[model samples]
Target chain A: MSGSPGAGRSRIVTWAVVGLCLGLAGALAWAMLDLPAPSTRLPGQVAAQLERSGVEHPVTAVLLNFRGYDTLLEIAVLLLALLGMLAAGVAPRASAPLGASSMLAALARALAPLMVLVAGYLLWAGAFRPGGAFQAGAVLAAAGVLLRLAGFLPAWTRPGAALRMALAAGFALFLAIAALGLTEGALLRYPEPSAGALILAIESGLTFSLGLILAGLFLAGPELPRREDGGGTP
Target chain B: MSLGLFYALLGGGLFALGLAGLILRPHLLAKIIGFNVMGSGAFLVLVGLGSRDGVADPVPQAMVLTGIVVAVAATALALALARRLLELSGDMVLPGERLRPGEDDDADA
Candidate 1:
């Protein structure tokens, strides 16, 4: 492969990349071994402040209360990524039922509602357990994908005004609450009395929107036309 | 070494491997997979290092959760862009590496 000078150069470049990465790995391992202990114990701090953070689960408390601004921006970033996809100009074609298997269709029909219920349960359980908006939203998105695969759901084309509103609602609500927190004292700082309710409200909106956005990421892409040589096989 | 430190070192190894794959792979999809691997490695390192003392740290865990979602979003965007490239060029390769007509581009390493 390296008979030509150009190929030799490519090989040299590959070697250089490999060498650099090996050095990086070595440095990282050395640093990890020699690192000083953290100046502050963050877990202790999080535990100490958990009572006032509005969630029984420390991770949830840290996510939606102590570091809510990050969550808020995260949703915005998701929305922006969806927007970037939409701007790529892959207009979806007219929907046709592609999944012809009766068993798959039947399974999707039976499971979609159950998946929604599971998503809801996860969102509700997040306050005190290992479940939350991200997990719930991912489950919801998976349901949507399953339905799409079963030909129960249509590919997203130009989303109507209602759909657009649904896509943005979570981020808008999050931003509005953050602004409200400014009046309360600082951004995203809820009153201790209503913190739980506020987080619940935010999570609910986020669940719906995040689900739609994640599903849209798959559904928004244009359906590739089938190649003559059977090139687009699944 | 503690379990957390061991995992941290493993994560570092994964990061290096992923970096190598990202740089060496010619296929856009493979590169995307490499990028995800790198992100996973970084997330593992963050959590592993934060918990090296044997106590679970909520802050880093929460941050990793956020990072996972962002990484998903970024992956979606990268895929969308790659699909566009494939559509426009009729090949899933970058412009600089594109082979001329009548030549087998996929034959090289």
Candidate 2:
């Protein structure tokens, strides 16, 4: 490749950008230098309020109960991104073998099931501990990506009606719940006795949708072919 | 002086580094990675700010968690676009520098 006329100008622009970035960074650091450690106002009250949300994990309660609106919008945003990818008209990569070693395939086979277990565990533990729907969904999606990379395209890579439904399930369920909550005088306000069940249900839907959405994104190169197996496991 | 402050400063640095990468790099993929770095920096800052009270704030933590999911979604979209651009143009660099109209040759490899 030969150097172009713009190369010199681009170099100068790059240096100027670098200087600007450095200055911005320094200014930000200096501005925050005097802030007190551990903000004076903690989320103690918010944490205490979690008991009323019918979940043991404060963060989970906050995400699914107190601030369900944000979660709802977030799921929507994820779906929107997936739609953008699909609209790009890129075909999924060919089904040709990924040139992976048999050992890698064997490893994927062993880990795939284990990943499911861990994801399930995380989803369950989210009600009481540090795990939640997003973490679980990500793990499940990682498993799918691993399988895809290892030349094990699940029979459902195509953006068929069923796959699309799964992708939309989380956002749809969340929106439904929010609408229902509106009838209860507050949007996303779950009844106390059923808050736990509702949150769990919503989380389950989210987990599935998020996993499928991620897998679809990973299969970005080609529009995945319709599975001949009619949704059966490969 | 607190650990949180240190992390916040680190977040600022990361943001700046990401900004520089985004601007200085001509490759679309590199810019995407830089965008992600910037996002993570913002997340770190949010997390640090939430920890201002000796106890971690669950609200901001939840926000950050949502942010992470959103960031990944955005990254995936960016990647898909980058891949598409590569497929169409036979190159992955941003258009302004490498793809001036009427320049048919790959001037700079």
In terms of lDDT, the best-performing candidate is 1
Off by over 4 Å in 2: A1-11, A36-42, A91-96, A154-158, A223-233, B99-109
| CAPRI class of candidate 2 | medium
lDDT of each: 0.86, 0.81
What lDDT tens digits, residue by residue, belong to model 1 across residues B4-43? Answer: 8888998998999998988787778878999999999999
Clashing pairs in 1: none
Q: What are the per-residue Cα lDDT tens digits for candidate 1 across A155-210?
A: 66677799999999999998888788988889898988889999999999999999
Model 1 - which docking category? medium
User: Model 2's A-chain: what TM-score?
Assistant: 0.84
lDDT of 2 by residue, A119-196 (tens): 999999999999999999999999998887666774333478877888899899988877878778988988788889
